[model samples]
Target: MADPIPETADTALVPTLLGDVIPRVESAYVLGLPSPQILDLVLERSRSTTVLVATDEEASQLKDELPDAVELVTAGIAAFAQDRRSQPRELVLALGGLDGLLPPADTMPWQQRLAHVTALAQAGGTVIVGLGNDAPLMALGHAERIDWARADDDPTRPTSAAALAQALAAAGQPVTTVHGLYGDPVNPGAAVIDALATGSRDGSLPAQVVEHVIDQAGTASIPAPDVVAVAARSGQLSNLATQWVAVSGGRGRSVYWTVDDAVVWADQDGPGLDWVIGGDADTAAALPQRVPDTITVERTLLRHIARADLPAFRAVARQLGDWVRSSADAAESSEIRLDEVRVAGATLARGISLRHAPVTDAAPVAEDAPDVEREPDPSARQVSASEARLAQAWRRFATRFAHSGRRSAWPAIFGEEDLVQLWLTMSGVAPGTVAPEADAPAVAVPAVVDEASRLDILQDRVAALTDTLAARDEQLLIREARIRTLRQQALGAARNRDRAVKLAQDLRRSRTYRLANQMRRASLVAQPKTLVRGVARKLDGKVRALRRTR
Candidate 1:
């Protein structure tokens, strides 16, 4: 098979930059190419295989550009979201056609479309969104912005890179500008080689100038990722939600979840330690004795363990325990810490007591994090009707609860007993009910149902039932006998009818009957009654004479 990733023009710079920062951020937006040229760049430079998601029109534009070896899925936002069966290593969302200027009738809102695309990013997959300058990128997420300034592509016009940087800075946003170099048309190989060697060749000078312009703009500031300010710890596990926020704390790092649910690897500059539960071969033996062999990570917008399995929860806690210990070991050296894990309403755990500072009052959570729960912002676009109904339901429920004069702000102020009771309720168990221990010896309790010992009575009832059935069977036999008698009578009638029909046919063919019919016809031939009578008498005499001769 042909190589999946074609080493084309020196498009490596953009892909290389994406490869470096995409793993670090929640999502990354490349604000340069109007097409999916950046996708090819990323694929050619990065070792990880990637796939492209595009609309029908976009896919049409991309026909024959990339080799058939690469997988491209053509689907709209909603269809793609519903049909995402597996996560690719990397995802490139071609959003050039989703220009902001287009009416909603023609195209979906770029913001919502972008949200869905970024939300599909796998735990380890890097999602690179390619869009034009008309669609703004800052409102999306903690997406690292890069300006690809193409040289000679449009030297006379203000390049998209320069214009985008100015727009972002005007909106008080930060952007990283990179010079995009293209190879010479005649000597493409030499030009690509030279540009790769020194960021730019002769044809790429315009891009270099655009980068300089962005630097001179003096408005854009490259700052660290901002940590969102969330409120204090909430009530019970049932009420409290796990939050995924874009913060300045963890850079060049992402918490990659393994496919086997074995570990959630936090890759960064730190001591190498695997936070593993059941799936890790080395630490499998060291796990808690009663840990489950497999774990189920909840499929929701929020990152949490949302299963009723206690053993799986313990296994998850063991992994989190490793993360906590690792965080504690490097607390002084590093800024990142694995704080309290917010369990789903279903996980069976109280709270983790950490030596370091307690988990931060989670900030107003960002809605862009994939594989985590995100509450929609009020200012954002309206969701589908079903989602709107759900939101309204929650609003109504919360409003009623608050108005009911109860002092409980469930999640924000849950007592230990309250949390336990809520967990029990969610688990379909009544409050104060003790769960039976499997290994414990069984004890005889007073029976609510009265015990009846009457084997003789049961025998008598069975005998009566048998007699009734036998009587029914006798009735059935009588019915069958009646049916047989009716059938015999019908057969006899059919035989008599057949014989009568045969006798009638034989009589009609007889010579005497034929002669009688001829005599009747000869009588009818006469005009008057007297003449007819005379002819009849003559015919009768002639018939008698003919009979005697025969």
Candidate 2:
């Protein structure tokens, strides 16, 4: 709410994530302190609204930001609930959840808070609650030491999605759908329903697609893709999600993913999943009309690697090569990355049709200017030409695979370059044609390793990279010294040249030199024949002198 953070591409994620589920109501009530952008979204969706914040400071801040039509309430949950006990709003949004809404000074029970929120919403009105998972998978990797002396302020707070959903249902507002939120809590990159996560199979398209979405939305510290892979295999992804959004009295889309700032959502109501993009109108318009294939070749390959299925991996690689050779043009082939290629039956399809054409802000063109066909920008063409060559793409994949901390089908001795060559050969590409750029020394990654060994591998890689950087730095220093010496020499030569020119100008400007030049000119004009004879005699004398010397 502090001057409303600048709207980014992902700014509309929360609103759009909840938009379909939120009923089109005339009035709404927002309890607790949600983001200003979210409030603005809520305001846009509803005609009239009321916002309640715990502190006077928050109320004062939001008062200037919210419109005049919106009624602002500043009080704790108990006070707000007592004041508005009789007035139940049509829609209630408590995205901040119970943590922020219940102040430490207030002794209100957790169940009572939930009851207050549900009571604030009229019967059949939507109540959306965004709750944090206290026992998320991240806790396993990054567990904080408990302070036994500290008081458990909110002991009854729901620890998991199920408990939160159960608590909400027990409060008379039965949850219709529970969405697992991933990435940033305030601005989640993905929102998937519990049903989809629970129903998806390990190698199915839905499972692959969900994993892909989770992969993109992973946290920095945890290897989310690997964690998700393990979790999905064990059928515990829903239970281990970072956060959950419990929706009561409304049904929402099954899956939501934020890609390039656009929101892609799909409902599991049809035979085939239909991904719909929702965001900037221009961006949505520019995207391919047809829905993208659910599963990506990268995801498929990753799954194969996870399961140590060498034959399947090789077959997919060959399929990808065939697709590149037969289906794609030269320009398109250069941009075909594994992640952007989709598995279409036995063949492969381009996952995103407009990878090269990024959505950009359209500047107004001059009306008077002629609509002439212009050549593509050479820089862009050069980039496209250099991007995603067969060897290069495979090399990138190999490097990722090496550092992925997942089990691989290849031998322990197989480094990134070895994997690259092997993959290229498997893909039916002539590895002999690959002129691989001189790369830093490869770190031999172990095929399988524990967390400690993985850390050791990472350290070894870092050490190798550091050595490479040091060598490059030494070369750079030598080049810099040579450049400095050349620059000094050039400057000295310029100064000498300036001095020589100055001296020449001084001689030319001297009175004696000027008088001599004028006298010579006058003599040549007055006695042209005499001057010519004298010049010939001088030349003859000079020739005799040169002949005598020789």
Model 1 lDDT tens row, 324-413: 334332232122212222223333111111122333322244467457466855555533332222222223333433443434323333
Q: Which RMSD values do the candidates have, in order?
A: 27.7, 28.9
- Model 1 TM-score? 0.22
Give each model a TM-score.
0.22, 0.64
lDDT for each candidate structure: 0.34, 0.68
Runs off by more than 4 Å, candidate 2: 1-10, 145-155, 200-220, 270-295, 302-309, 328-334, 352-388, 405-408, 411-414, 440-550
Candidate 2's error at 322, in angstroms? 1.4
The number of clashing residue pairs in each candidate reads 10, 0
Backbone clash pairs for candidate 2 read none
Q: What is the lDDT of candidate 1?
A: 0.34
